[model samples]
Target: MLDQLCHILLLVVVSILYHVTFFLPPSWVSVLRISVLLLCAAKPVSVMFTELFGRFRPMPGEGTEGAGKVIGYLERLILVILMVVGEYGVIGWIIAAKTFARSRQLADSQAFCEYFLVGTLLSILSSISLYLVLYRW
Candidate 1:
């Protein structure tokens, strides 16, 4: 409970700082924006899952939690990059690939399906939201 609160607080602080990057030098803006985006996609999203679904335990033959975290980080980063480059159509392919990869597990367990769906949606939404906030502000 307390840990979740801390994560939420940290996310809020980073979001506030994200806005401040606009005041920085133009050369630093891109780097800082990417850095902040990655930061938001990482721990905060994991914390969000924890809060929403409780602890996630992968079924047998599934990858470890750390691997899932890394994958989520990479997934969100890639989505953000795609958005920045205005490749919105490609986003569907990425989501489709992910869903296909997890198809067996998603079909096997109801809980896993819900977790994957919510996590994927949250990740995608967060990436889009972050991009809009940073670039459109």
Candidate 2:
């Protein structure tokens, strides 16, 4: 719990720093913005995801706790980077790959399917939205 709080605080600091460093070069600004936005979105977006999909709960031994959060963070990081670089095709591949990677878990439970789908979709949507708003390039 404390670790999570620290992680959140760090992200918030980075976000503030990203906004304040407008005098920096555009490339540095973009990278900082991406880092802050992705980190900042990870927890809140996930909380919203759980609230929005409250009907579906994870099954026992179905998924790891922090693992999902870390995976989501990395996923969004990659997605935002890809978006910035305009590799739209690879983004589709990433989604497909994630889906395939979790095929067994997704296939095992209907609730898990809904949970995974909604979470993945929310992650993608949030990444795109953040990129549209924060990214200068």
Candidate 3:
């Protein structure tokens, strides 16, 4: 139980840092840890979705099936939101939530722009990949 809680806490931290930094937690150790967390989060969600919807089983077997559908769709939608949120989230995490060009909150302007650009590019690429992954079979 405690171990699970710690894992959850680590996920929250990693996700939080994901937006703030492209290759978050720069150290090799931190990067590896974060990568593991991301893999952990993503794998379960995808597997559970596939299992519940196994072989076109959109709602899965039973038990928490209904709840899973609701939560799964909601979660997929939230993932899209988070993708966009990372746009300003990174900037805000560094600057202020009210950050803008006019705000003059460009502390790490160069680094921020670089990271933001890469993030945006990766976002588009990932969206396309996500579409193909979900629909193309």
Candidate 4:
């Protein structure tokens, strides 16, 4: 209980410092908000996908769980940042770059490709929806 309280206190302090130090515009504020939301949602989303993909469309090899979760969180953060800055084109490039990097591995495995695509799509959709909700431009 004490550890949890300290951790929560630390998180609050850090979040306050981050907001105070950053010179974010209104839309960028939404980005920050969405990033936090994504961070919290990452694990639940991963579990949901694990059930959907792992059961229905199982990939052959086991992935590094922590790394994948961190990567997805970072990916959502980047997408939110890009959207807030109106760099919609960069989002496509980001996706393309990911595809290029994974092309060789994905080429040999349809199940892996499906898993990757579904996760990417979910991240993109969540980022876009958050942006639209906050800054309906």
Candidate 5:
């Protein structure tokens, strides 16, 4: 319960940062919002709750097979985040440069940097959450 609340609050903070920083198209923004919200609120909460109810693995036991799989899923998000960062940091600037050829009002570098920052913040938040979730120490 406490964990869920913490995650929700973090998600809210991340959402605000994303909106204030990125200039994503409405369609992409909506999709990104839903994806982040679902993972932050629903996925981890469900994992913890289910573990509480069904079965929990001992710290060093053979019965904890699913633990590795769950952890792998969480860890892979970091790789995805790295890709997102590269895209926002580099590809975004390229696009902005191209768009600038037509419209002089767009601040491609600023937009890219903002998106990169937001992505970094989110990845950090999620990674911290994962550490908390996976490690009891």
Candidate 6:
């Protein structure tokens, strides 16, 4: 319970800091906002993801857990860029590519399918939430 509270507090603080960036000079706003967004995604969002779904163990030979973290980072970065550019439709291509890459695991293991779906949805939600917080000011 304490851990969950900390995670929620971290997100709220990050969201507030991200919004604060909007008040900076125009040139600094983009750089600062993206930096903060990426930073938040890197650690806090990962913790949130783990808290929500870490119980689902990966299948044997599924690859290193580090790789998943890297993928999640890249996924969130791409999503934030797409959202910033108003290319929401292209977001589907990212999902398609991930699905294609993991087609085998997705097909063979029900556990992996649920894990993948949950992780992907969480990643998308985090990215969109960060984007909205950063720009909605």
> Among these predicted structures, which one has the highest lDDT?
6
lDDT of 1 by residue, 6-44 (tens): 877877876686679778898787787777777776777
Pitting candidate 5 against candidate 6, the one with the higher lDDT is 6
lDDT of 3 by residue, 1-137 (tens): 67558768976885676567655446754555434433443444445444543464322232453453344343343444444344524432422322343134235455444433443343334443453443243
Off by over 4 Å in 3: 1-108
C-alpha lDDT values of all predictions: 0.79, 0.79, 0.43, 0.70, 0.47, 0.83
Query: Native-vs-model 2 lDDT?
Result: 0.79
In terms of lDDT, model 4 sits at 0.70
The global Cα lDDT (0 to 1) of model 6 is 0.83
Model 1 misplaced regions, further than 4 Å? 1-24, 55-65
Scored by TM-score, the top model is: 6
Task: Show the colliding residue pairs in model 4.
Answer: none
* Order by TM-score, highest first: 6, 1, 2, 4, 5, 3
Q: Sorted on lDDT, highest at the top, how do the candidates line up?
A: 6, 1, 2, 4, 5, 3
Candidate 5 clash pair list: none
Q: What are the per-residue Cα lDDT tens digits for candidate 6 across 29-109? A: 677767777777666788878777888857557477578878998998889888888999999999999999999989998
Off by over 4 Å in 2: 1-28, 50-55
In candidate 5, position 129 carries an lDDT of 58
Find the 10 residues in a row with the least total lDDT in model 4.
36-45
| Residue 32 lDDT (model 6) | 70
TM per prediction: 0.74, 0.72, 0.26, 0.63, 0.30, 0.78
Tens digits of per-residue lDDT, candidate 4, 1-137, equal 67557657856974785667467676766566655555534554565566666665544465564665677777877887788688999999988887887788689888778777888898788778767865574
lDDT of 5 by residue, 74-132 (tens): 43354334434444354345434434542432243454344334433443455445434
Q: What tens-digit string does per-residue lDDT give for candidate 2 at 66-115?
A: 67767887888888889878897899999999999989988988877887
